[model samples]
Target: MHRRTFLKSSAAGALVMATTSWPLGARTRDRIRVAMIGTGLRGQSQLGPLLSRDDVELVAICDTQQVMLDKTLAIIEKTGRRKPKVYGGNGDVRAWKALLAQKGIDAVFIVTPWEWHASMSIAAMQAGIAVGCEVVAGITLQDHWDVLRAQQRTGTPYMLLENVCYRRDVLAVLQMVRAGLFGELVHMQAGYQHDLRAVKFNSGNPNEPYGSGAEFGDKGFSEAQWRTQHSIDRNGELYPSHGIGPCAMYANIHRGNRFTHINAFASKARGLHEYIVEHPKGGANHPNAGVKFKLGDVVTTTLRCENGETILLQHDTSLPRPYSLGFRVQGTDGLWMDVNKSIHVEGKSPAHKWEQAQKYYDEYDHPLWRNYAAKAAGAGHGGMDWFVIHAFIEALKANTPMPIDIYDAVAWSAITPLSEQSIAEDYKTLAFPDFTEGKWKDRKPIFALDGRY
Candidate 1:
């Protein structure tokens, strides 16, 4: 079916969803009342795109910090949008629960720290609210299961908010794969290769609210800047979604294929420790300055897919390095690499040479991009965020399955903890938790060039 026809049908299907009274987003008028939790950097970035929409109403904004709550409310008001109900998560742990209990909200976006994902998401679904959560679903193996079980029990659909999957170039390559431009997929490589040294160390910048001490607590850092704290405690791939999300989509993970096992190797932790030791800010006598960080600057994880394909994942955020997700999809016929933005067709290309991938983009940009690439969706991360939020709202209004559902969320995010375990055991091959319990074998792909998402 054509992309437009599929979207129209999906829109029609969304209407059928409105008949149900128990579900939150399944309202008859197709107007979605939304709530945003953690209105810091990530959450604040989402406001422009969300506020621009006529069908979406920002009914509430929740954050543990008073600054974020009041700031976001003012921003929403400036848009002439309704002043969203504010929920301060400061000292009270259940502040958001009260907001979720308030009858009006249809969906909640959990953009908080790594730890709260499962609990908040499970709670929101139980409260009859749909969810759009940020990456790295949960912090533990059990956390992953709870997220899946809660959504399943509540019969609520969720979007993982993996924006990289919808990136224009990423989508273009996906289109090529769907069109058989790359034949018989074999191996792929992706990674988090950005240097976040300054970000990890500059924890208390007074000018920027995110950099302020409120993110982790009054302990000189707030949970919003929790990545640094996470590094001090863990040793393996602390965050893997930026690299894994796109590769998972290309590999068709949790749809027809799943990661069978993981073997991880880590270089000794050096970045954060060295930064503290060298900097004058955190006196050398300070406990944190003298502490040893367990997380390695570089971690390499290899995943074996059930279909005999291999994925090479690199976790390299701590050290000095230029940013590169290293998105490379290779097959029997050709290969495409994101860092270089180039592809080579096996027999059709000049002998063993890399050609400009720009040549193929016009012909192969995905159907989704063909429709909305030029139109600004008022979102960040190179306009992909708009598409993801668009998909989430559309799914909510239409009452369809999210493009990146609970299974995908768990399967992709579980890598961090699983990699930690593998590295702890001297790089032993660890089996992955089958969150789907083998249902991937028969599940049809929810995301497609058909544009149903």
Candidate 2:
């Protein structure tokens, strides 16, 4: 759809949503009334603790599964918190729309699957409510583009909750980088390496904690079903931000530079495809794998920023290994590498290698740490989760610019389809869309308020 027509439709949808009743009272003056959608694994498991904060009021909950909603509400009730009204059954968007229409709700949290991310976020923004969406914010490249436009048209703040940016070690690296300890920040390497072939492919019978039957079902089902059940590999860097977040900080992506081009390549997955072929009942026999992926292992994507800085992002869910983000920043002055816990320098300074690298690291246990770190400590992916949420809230409350604004969301999320396109074209380099219109070049990097630098 054209941008204008799509936006008009979205605006109409928002108008319909705004007609619902709300319970705005004295209580809402202090708390940001929030409604959470999709209370499944990520929602209840990792996001629940972070959302149940004092500054926010969990007013309503929506889910496809009634039992999951009930469990979530029960937990809230047990905590002596205000129990949220539950909505289930067909058309969760309508239920959430009603919640958004209500005057009681100031914001909506979208914990839904990747498919619903764009629509839900757009709906919330149109309904005059701020939105917080999980990582890699949009589903398609068009979705990412539309979201940025929607945010602009509606003037509602939208946040992509990239929790990895607030990791303790990552935050420390930012501080050191700001101190010129990391030098010119030449290049970076990071990744989210996780193996889930068995569960993903559904090997050895069906294991469903929520229910029965194989999650992917038979191979003749629907393409949509496969998307949810299988790994998020529609694009090469479909999940790049887990690694890109830390890398972006070191490279100063939104601060002064931006990703210029990206080239991605997927390693031969013939071995994995053959394994699935040999063991049809091993879970890979499902219709989900009908004919799409015939490859085996890794999908490595390389991003080239405007300043000639490069970021290497790699992910492979078909392999088995402990989750590790190989984060390293190779700067011109000094280098901070988490993989080897070493620092390299090429200046007229002390030849500090292993010993000095230890000193370079800062312990996140200070008084200011207590203030900013308390709320963020409970966030998923270490503590980066809460920081993203809190920062967005602070932006809305204080009427300040979002720490990671629409431009950042677009730039970060652009890796999704861009990398996919690159990989499809045999790892051809694709120029990145200038989401910021070069505005980020005039902005300064947002540093932690803890005075670490």
Candidate 3:
């Protein structure tokens, strides 16, 4: 079947499901009415727990592709949960206006592809709904600017759900950083390197993987798609936040300082070209096999923060290697390194190495995290996800400040396209667009609730 026709059929089926489900805001419960947009693999598989919680109500679901929508609806069906209204449109396709029009929805969880993050988020915010958007936050430099404007204009909270910040080990490192164990954090390194080409593609039958439910099933896209078929030769830091999150936390990024400027460098695209040329399946017919691709496969960006702190952000997607976030932090008084999983202190009488790090650095108790850890622990991202949601709901409940303010979301996602521009210019340094208008300098961590270790 044609992709468009199949998508339309799935969309109609979704409307049917929505009619059968409970009406929006039916019970008048205190649950935060939430909606899931782009219910693809990541949103369906991972977002289930958060939506299922009693604290929130899933009032609506939207997606451009029908296959994913059906999969998401099935989850709602099995849980006996009040199913949400479903909408389908491809890339600002159709359901957005109607989805945002739902007055019952208090917040929207956007898990769409990188391109649509900014516009969809802006639309939802303008509709008076808080937005929790997926990573690669903004697609273009102007898009980043537009998102901040929308948030400020609407007074709706905007959050980038960068779950890496909540990973178990990353949290452990944050605990240490909070205690001043990493005193005067100096420089850091972070990156995301995971090669999935072999596992992402099946050599034999193109359509062997069937069923949306199967782990390796259709997986949504066809084999002819770009991300799977094309080799990422000289790709600039493809996935950066796995390293950026830990680095940002260690450097006290939002508390006072901010990233100032960055210079990027990318390796030649020869390796990926060779693979496309040599692969038996498609030799001369391969795209760019004979013609060289301009972009490099690996890109490393060096950043200098407003406070003179330096950081290294690397991206290597072409080669096969074990996944590593490459998190490391150094401070004036002490240092906590993820690669070593060890902490070092300046005092001569260093009682214990790792123990000392834990005592001084990894003590999870913080004035901000102490109060909400229990409630947040049940959510995803090893509890951080809960914290993020807590901050959003609390802002609505108390009319207080947003945990991750509009500027934070803008800054976190701005790196997506800016990094790309840096690579295009032969890794020349690119000045970061200041979304805060110099206001972020005084910004605190926005830690609303206390966290206990």
Q: What is the C-alpha RMSD of each candidate to the true structure, in Å?
A: 7.2, 5.1, 7.5
lDDT of 2: 0.66
Task: Give lDDT per model, in order.
Answer: 0.78, 0.66, 0.63
lDDT of model number 1: 0.78
Writing each residue's lDDT as its tens digit, candidate 3 over 186-277 gives 88888866654443333333334221111222332532122433233324555566677667766766678788997778777655455555
lDDT (Cα, tens digit) per residue for candidate 2, span 1-453:
143454476696664453332222212234677778878656775445545567777888887656567667777777788677777744344565556556667777788767677777877787878787877678678988888877776767677777777666677677677667656777888887765444444421212432122334342122223342434346476577778877887777878888888888887654334435555453566543454553336888888888898888887665657767778787777666676666676663467754345555554232334566665555566665556667666555554456666777777877878877888787799998888777878988764453321
User: Which 10-residue window in model 2 sums to the lowest lDDT?
Assistant: 19-28
lDDT of 3 at 64: 72
Q: How many times do residue backbones clash in model 3?
A: 19
Q: Over 4 Å off in model 2, which ranges?
A: 1-7, 10-29, 46-48, 90-94, 198-235, 270-296, 346-358, 363-379, 447-453
Clashes of each: 6, 8, 19
List the candidates ranked by lDDT, beginning with the highest. 1, 2, 3
lDDT of 1 by residue, 232-265 (tens): 7898877788778878888888889999989899
TM-scores, in order shown? 0.90, 0.83, 0.78
Against the true structure, whose lDDT is highest?
Answer: 1
* 2 versus 3: better lDDT goes to: 2
TM-score: model 2 vs. ground truth: 0.83
